[model samples]
Target: MSAGGRGGVRATLSGLTTRGRSFLAAGIAAAVCAYVLGQDDLLRVGLLLAALPLLCAAVLHRTRHRVTAERGLAPARVPATGEARVRLRVDNVSRLPTGLLMLQDRVPYVLGPRPRFVLDRVEPGGHREVSYRVRSDLRGRYRLGPLQVRLSDPFGMCELTRSFSAYDTLTVLPRVEPLPPVRFGGEALGHGDGRQRSLALAGEDDVIPRGYRHGDDLRRVHWRSTAKHGELMVRREEQPRRSRCTVLLDTRAAAYEGAGPGSAFEWAVSGAASVVAHLLERGFSVRLLTDFGVTVSGEGGSGHERAAAAALMMDTLAVIDHSDGADLAGAYDVLRDGHDGLLVAFLGDLDGGQAASVARMRRRGGAVAFVLDPDAWTREPTAVPEPNAPLPQRLRVLREGGWTALGVPRGASLEELWRQADRERPGPAALSGKARG
Candidate 1:
């Protein structure tokens, strides 16, 4: 069938009920009998019954009530397991009263239950407001609704439904916990000039012109520099601060194994969020690297800039999903770009090649890894066959390669686990220029 024809049939069927059809059928049969046998009682009853439905249908078919809705979401972005209020204001725009109006705001399954309200009567040009709270224990972006409003006759036989094409979006960010007071001692907490360089880079601004050149915008001329240098000098724009930590999150699906919210993937996400929060709190510029080489960096040391960066990070993390790609080592090249800061990684399951790629970061400053013990988290005894070396062996390799690696067991307290300080290790040798891929 043609799409329009099918739609028309469905629309027609939705507005009618079996009871109405039965009544119409009986009325028609009675009317036929009355006309053939000249029965007055049957004729009167049939005409009255048949006219009732027609009258109801005519009255409802012409129903033209319009409503303007304004939706409000308090704290439009919330952390997982957080509550937010959804308020809706509906204004009637018809000349006559609308029949019982039923309004429901559609919500995604993850965002708790849908909010519903009913108005017995909406007088012409009147308005009503309703509010409800919604909470989600998971993270992601969700659409609140295209409001569904239904109007029905007093007898409930005839009905009309109109969906307002307006929607509101909700973003549920990952939960960030307070980091325990712990630092992997040694160069990981860069001392001396490294700290100074990090601070200086953080305070630097965007590139600006020191002296005006041809094709430069006249508006960019620095009046003070021109007065001092006897030439048209534009403010020099410099690059923003160099990020201090490259937070690489292993999103490769094969690395971690578990199910639902308790899976190793979620634990890795939480660990990443916690580490990012901790780095920001410690006044470090961070570059978030995920899914191989997708990098996100924030430039300024100012409070506003830091807050903006944190918000961006959380927003990005809220929507991160697992990748099917097995080789997550592609992020190493990007990590090699910055050599002055620490490298923090949340690793899932890993193969030898991937582990070796991660070890290359040792040439940089300090590298710390929070490795998930996938075997500990799996429920089935043989969820994954251990035909080769175990996860601890991989972590031992990481530790030997100048990384302060920690194996995280399932059901362990993140606060406690992260807080436990690692033993001091030798600093990485100074390596300049680009490292080979």
Candidate 2:
């Protein structure tokens, strides 16, 4: 017998329905009673009662079932608080007709409950299609799939569950808002030490072939190019200049307050997303950096490279979570290693160490920070003075270290914040002048 037929037999034997079990128990009891009392009538009734289950088991044992499923998503990727429609198509590929079948498409709890349906029957070589909608306010990659179909006997005496091991991934990206162009002071950024240049040079080099230089290896000659140019042309190992922007998002859980979408961490993530989008749109190679110094997305190239990089960055931001393990200062050490055109940070209330790290990043390029007031986001108001105390002290430290720092409320709009940072002065004076009352 075929594997599917053997599987069906095994499933029929193992998956005895409630009614089937009850009938079998009644048959056994009746048979025992009839044997003890020498009653032929009871024995005949027991045999009749037991015949239904035996027939069901035998029918299922010989049945073979096979199905194929395909799943499609209307929009596979979406922003936070977006919805998508999932369409499922199931096809019966067996020669025998399938009995009553139930279908369930599993989904993540964040999206919604699993969608379930019941079908009376699917004829041989027949098909059925179903669709459902899923929505989530949270951001992350979700799997929608592995169609579970339960095949049962006509009388519901036995059931066999078969899983179609197919899955589709839906990526829920972070909410990216538009930001006004903000200028970074022309501090001499590290020239030609960009991530893209290094990666392109070592891994996938995209270069032109020029005339062979002194002591150039014969193997380095581009034969095709040499033939075209009618001269010995060797691959040029020059680093092309591409503007770089590093967006630092603070992810230390202790640094932010509140929970869920309205939390300071989420605000920072949104702000970072906006900054990343704005930079990439302006033709700057952007890299997303976290307090843990994790490089979620590295510098992008022009055109398709930039677009792919931006998409990956937005997807990365969707699932970014706060980390409390890495020291803020230690993480900032990554900033000193490379030169970036612009360093924009979305930060929460910072301690002295964290503030000092921000200061260190100023040397890399034009450092600008959008610092959020954590106390305002908390349930209970803190005693620390907002404008006259802690916020001002932190701003002073960052400004003194040569950073343009803007203090923002938890509920401030990122666009407005970016515009203000663009026109505002650097240092504690800017905070005092633009500090919200």
Candidate 3:
């Protein structure tokens, strides 16, 4: 509602307390019996009973006491399944003291149970603070609330409810598990070499002009840079590149199987988040992108800024949804554009065409693959595997294509897989380059 005052007398009267309603009901019955029995005493009692609640209602409706609420969330951004505290402060601004306050906060069921608080009383011109903890397993942004409080009259015959308009948002980031760090064969180059390679990927606006050569094309001359340098300068046809590590996640609905948190898709997202965090902490410039080409990039930083960037990345990963793309064509182009960088991909099931498309990106840079094991995915979550074959052929396909690939089980720990990856040697083509195979 716009304001408590907006609820007119009719609305206010509708808030008649349970006691009030019962008393009124009893009074009506008594009056009816009195009429049939012709009893004057009963009639007089009935009149008094019926009048009391009405009088209380009228008294409550006339109250001009004003209430205001302020809400706050501590550590508003939390990881999935993490807890956050919500503090709500309510004030009585009117001249009259409040009778009682029954406070309840509105929240979604996913965020756990609603919190209710009881305050004995609040003096006029005074305020009280109450707090509750909320936890959610799901990742997304959730609103905490406009606080609603029930105010009662002294006799308890009537009560009114008022709601504060203020709302607070809590961001639940995807769970980013810490992973052990390991050197990658295609992860980095000599600092100078990497920088030079990065320039080749620069955008037009990032053009760094150089002294014009004898064979330089006139069309390539950078007019602005020439004026600034006071000499003929030609645009360096280098592709601008700063991203050192790219984490590609397959969001195509067809690529993944199952639903919910225990599914391969969710496991992949969580693992991707972990890998992104590990890279950021290691001072690597990172980029996270979906197969559909949606991307989020963060500059390399080790302090407060790193935390902020991680939050940004986590926020994006938290809300990412499955895509409708049938193939990895969008991602293929993205992966094939970088050089002297590390490309880490978390993919679902891959057919021959998809695997071939993914493999072709290896020539542009080193690649690491996390593929879901079809055998594990086809089984129930509670089913135990009997050490049977787990799609060795698919993993072999990616390995032969020069990727350091590992098969991920539906409910397996990513940290364990990271250890396994570090123990294994990369393909010969990994340290150098890969031709389409």
For model 1, how does the per-residue alpha-carbon lDDT over 210-281 read when each residue is reduced to its tens digit? 777888888767676677779888755443344377778999988877656668888888778877877775
Candidate with top lDDT is 3
TM-score of each: 0.77, 0.77, 0.78
Clashing pairs in 2: none
Which window of 10 residues has the lowest lDDT sum in candidate 1?
1-10
Number of the candidate with higher lDDT, 1 or 2:
2
Residue 204 lDDT in model 3? 61
Q: Provide the RMSD of all predictions against the true structure, rounded to 1 decimal.
A: 7.0, 7.5, 7.4
lDDT of 2: 0.74
Q: lDDT tens string, model 3, 1-437?
A: 12254477788778888999988888888999999999999999998899888887775665434777778899899998899999888787777777777899998888988999988777888989999999988788888877788887777988888776778889888888888867664333212234344354446667777899998899989898888889999977754334478889998898777776667888888899999988887767788988987788886664887788788899898888899999888877776676457778899888877887887766545578899865588687788876646456667877877877898876788888887876774755545545533
Please provide, for model 2 over 35-126, each residue's C-alpha lDDT reduced to its tens digit, 9 standing for 90 to 100: 99999999998887788787777765554346666788989998888889998776767787777878898899989999998887778889
User: Global CA lDDT of candidate 1, please?
Assistant: 0.71
TM-score of 1: 0.77
